[model samples]
Target: MATLSAGGQQDAACMHIRELTMNACKVAHSAAGAVAEGIATGVNALLETVRPREIELDRLDREIDSAVTTHITGATEESAREMLACMKLSIGMERIGDLLLGFSNRALVAASRCEMEDVRDLTLMASRLEKMLSEVREAFEMRNLDKALAVLRSDAEIDRLRNLVFVRHLENPGGTHRSESFHVVFMTQALERAGDHVKNMAEEVCHLVSGQSVRHLLRSIDKPLEQMFLDQLRTKHAL
Candidate 1:
């Protein structure tokens, strides 16, 4: 009788342990799903901000800021830490957008008094930078490392264009008025810094996905890594 009672107790304890484990797994899965949903929502909101639509950029910034805060505070898992890092990167990218908008506003204000030729080069540079900005944002949304790396490479092009425009303005002070020259310099610096932020975000993406810091890797290496990711996607598709 004692043996029977002991065996019964053991079975009950095993069942309890199994139930506990299953419950824990369910909770973990629920938390992971929530985190993924939050990230997707945040990315979508950011894309809307980048759209050429008349939406207020400040509103998008506030939305992203709130999302980052919630993502960091709402979860207590290691994965949440990675998510927080990505959110921080997103914040930086969004700030770039804000800066770009400021430049646009300032350019519009200065248009009344500024010579078109004086600001023409700067305007062209701004247009190219804006395209790069869009590409970086798209890379993040799609998690395309290749596109992100391409955006990084394009930064050098932007820097070159900025330098060229600055040099032209310096060579002929009469070509660009003093105040306009200063404003151009300021806006160009902001755009260059925005490119840097986009590159930084690309590095964060690599770290988040692979647990590896490839920030030091050359742009050359990033190409192969991107190809590897593409190959993996292809394999998954085949399966």
Candidate 2:
């Protein structure tokens, strides 16, 4: 093998970091998919899909920590930025994995008790979370800012699903409460928190590839859909 130059070595290190980060992301995305599948199918499917993967996510997290520690020592400025982004991405993915596992645990107990509407809302939340993770991965791989923005926009739907679930469970006008309402609310919150982490990843991707925050990028955008999202976000935050 030829001796590699310092820059070549850094490039190789950055690639390793990116790959590790992507692996963690995939596991997180898988966890979200498991939640949807579990809620849709049954507990057996959830156990098969979710139980063993937490260990895998933990292993990936450790490997990413090692990669960042080993690679950042002599990295050039650009490479260091890339490594930091990888580090941030891995952190978010790990948290998402944990949240999804918790969601699965709640789902395992909640499945038999859940009504059709409960199942419907929770499954939709999981599906949206999975989509957000998918788009974030695509954005990272392609350095596509639009995909990242799409992930950001998709989060609004997840939040809306969450609010709908809460209103049905907590504020039911009929004054009827289901026994599984607690579990349903917890599961919704778990998926919503996971979406928040995914949103963070999307924002990180925006900053990583463009050197600007998502808000700054939105400010310069002229697209109607994106502008609508920004306005709604502003209105929501104002409330």
Candidate 3:
């Protein structure tokens, strides 16, 4: 057995970190591909394409955690924040993989029964989320603040689609298998959660690039919501 000398050991460790980081990146790309293929193949073939990747995703996430712990050796504040962001990004990707798996399972159950009340919104949700995942990966890779902001902005439509599905479910959640509607609901919930994780990753990317939170950007875009709260406060004060 050839023993590694001290410098060789350091080089080996650095190479491990690089491989781990690339695997973390591969997890993100694989999840994104799974999501896109799931959407394209519809509900039935989704598991065939996506389920095969879940175990690999989990393995990549474990590698990422090990790499971050072993490689992120720095005392500066920026470095600390960068490591934190990197960890969050890994967790966010893992959560997205979980959500995609959940989506496939619930959709499979739904398929055994009936179609959704309306699938148009669900289709749109999947498409938008696929785009968001790609943008998140790219923004993080490039550290482009604007691209990160766009990824965050795209999450709003996912939220809207989730709300639409819920409203539709409330209106006509009646079928031979009334429980079937809830499967669609569950699927939408998974997609919504996946979008949330994408947003989380995007926020971390924004933080990495700007060294600041994205809350201010949100507040600026949500002026109408702020005004609505202000109006409610004024009405309460008058009462």
Instruction: Estimate the TM-score of every prediction.
Output: 0.56, 0.91, 0.75
- Cα RMSD, each candidate: 14.1, 4.3, 7.8
Model 2 regions lying over 4 Å from their true place = 222-226, 230-239
Winner on lDDT between 1 and 3 is 3
Instruction: Compute the lDDT of residue 222 as modeled in candidate 2.
Output: 50
State the lDDT of candidate 2 residue by residue for 89-117, as single tens digits.
88888888788888887777768779998
Which prediction has the highest TM-score against the true structure?
A: 2
**Best-to-worst ranking by TM-score:** 2, 3, 1
How would you encode candidate 1's per-residue C-alpha lDDT over 96-166 as one tens digit per residue? 55555555455444534555554554555555555555565555456676676666666666677677767
Per-residue CA lDDT of candidate 3, range 73-174, in tens? 642455556655767777777777788888777665554454444456666787888788777777866778878877766787789889977876766545
Q: What would you estimate as the lDDT of candidate 3?
A: 0.69
lDDT per model vs. reference: 0.51, 0.86, 0.69
Clash number for each model: 0, 0, 0
